[model samples]
Target: MDRFVLTDAQWAKMEPHCLGKPTDPGRSGANNRLFLEAVLWIVRTGSPWRDLPATFGNWSTAFRRFRDWREADVFKRIFDALTEEPDMEYAMVDATIVKVHRHGQGAKGGLRARPLAVPKAA
Candidate 1:
């Protein structure tokens, strides 16, 4: 199963905001898209960096790069770029599917229960 989360259009939107273009002074990122995918995979699966797939390259390297990007606000820039035109297709919440338990609906003897008064000291 393909685990990649970024579509080509999304990647294009975020590409310019990523660090390490050949024009930058420091060493360019080997493959920014793959690195971003690695980070996304970790997030999507809620897995620790140590469990990153071998296809994403060394887990440590990916983690370190993620740290750098976080500190540099690269991810924020990418998010901003993508949100320029938000997609609301999956944003709706269905009220019918949501359930309120009896306790949650202010059932008797819950928060309404009065606390017993402390005995007066002699």
Candidate 2:
């Protein structure tokens, strides 16, 4: 019933498409709704997860879940589903293309532990 959290309609939109394993049951009725709220908090405030308010679940738990969702491809599916239907015949690119700096490759090591958001078809 809280407007700050996802409403039933939003949950329904997500429920049908998300096939990943649900969060494990801990204390009875621990539905991990806070997990979702934590993610929403991150977007709403754009704060580091460690700075997430204690009213939400542990920051590490929320972040681990966020990273897990990234690894599982769940976040991409949600993004693709929530986006307005693509223009089949028309595409838009707003950015100027530029060659990568020589230091760009230095960032490769940090990426080894996380899945990058690379386009599948590219």
Candidate 3:
């Protein structure tokens, strides 16, 4: 798929957790992977639903599907499945070494005071 976000392996992990599979009794979701990509696009760009591009399908339909998934907690299950094993290799943070400039720590006189003020000419 063009402009794809989830790799094949990642989609494999999440596919089983998604609803409306062809094997199921109810209506099968049309292109679940594409729907997921649409949702991801919205999140990645932080854009409003109306701004969703035409490539991902109708924005309203995708939004409704997102709401349904949210209500079913499908996203949580997907997240849990993908994060079963915590990868800490790149998650480490060194908080021991830190530096703060003097201006950052409520400098003398504070920032509320105006540094320059000029009288208006009549």
Candidate 4:
């Protein structure tokens, strides 16, 4: 799979916030750019971690790294930094184009009138 590549401007924004730099105390990450690409691949394709391509390294290692970064809030920081300038121009949504499934419309009797039983605690 062709991995996602961050633009120079985007990388500049995220570089400082990422973990495992050469100056960092712990074992340095193999390559922050490649790691980001691996993460993007998972998110973009919506694939299970185990399906990660061999070029990205072991799937389990990537998943563990992802968990560690999540715990440290690195993803949130990157999002905030990159989205600092809100692009309101493209924010408008056309509700008319949206569709809802028939079964999701709720029962004929409505929600409140439906018979609901409370389970007894075991």
Which candidate tops lDDT?
3
* TM-score per candidate: 0.66, 0.53, 0.71, 0.67
Off by over 4 Å in 2: 19-32, 84-122
Each model's Cα RMSD: 7.1, 18.1, 10.4, 11.1
Candidate 1 C-alpha lDDT tens digits along 2-113: 6567888888998899898755664345788888888889998999999999999899888988998999998899988888887797787796768888677875666556
Candidate 3 structure quality by residue, lDDT tens digits, 2-117:
55899999999999999997655532367889989988988999999999999988888889889999999999999999999988887766755555777777757775766678
Better of 3 and 4 by TM-score: 3
Q: List the residue pairs that clash in candidate 1.
A: none
Off by over 4 Å in 4: 1-3, 23-28, 93-122
Worst 10 residues of 1 by lDDT: 21-30
Model 1 scores a C-alpha lDDT of: 0.84
User: What TM-score would you give candidate 3 relative to the actual structure?
Assistant: 0.71
Candidate 4 C-alpha lDDT tens digits along 1-122: 35357887999999888988866554336677788889998998999999999998889888888899999999999999999998887777686766677776777765566567888899
lDDT of predicted model 3? 0.86
Please list the C-alpha lDDT of all candidates, in the order they appear.
0.84, 0.66, 0.86, 0.83
Per-residue error (Å), model 3, residue 59: 0.6
* Per-residue alpha-carbon lDDT of candidate 2 for residues 82-103, written as tens digits (9 for 90 to 100): 6656656645444464556677
Residue 50, candidate 1: C-alpha displacement in angstroms: 0.7
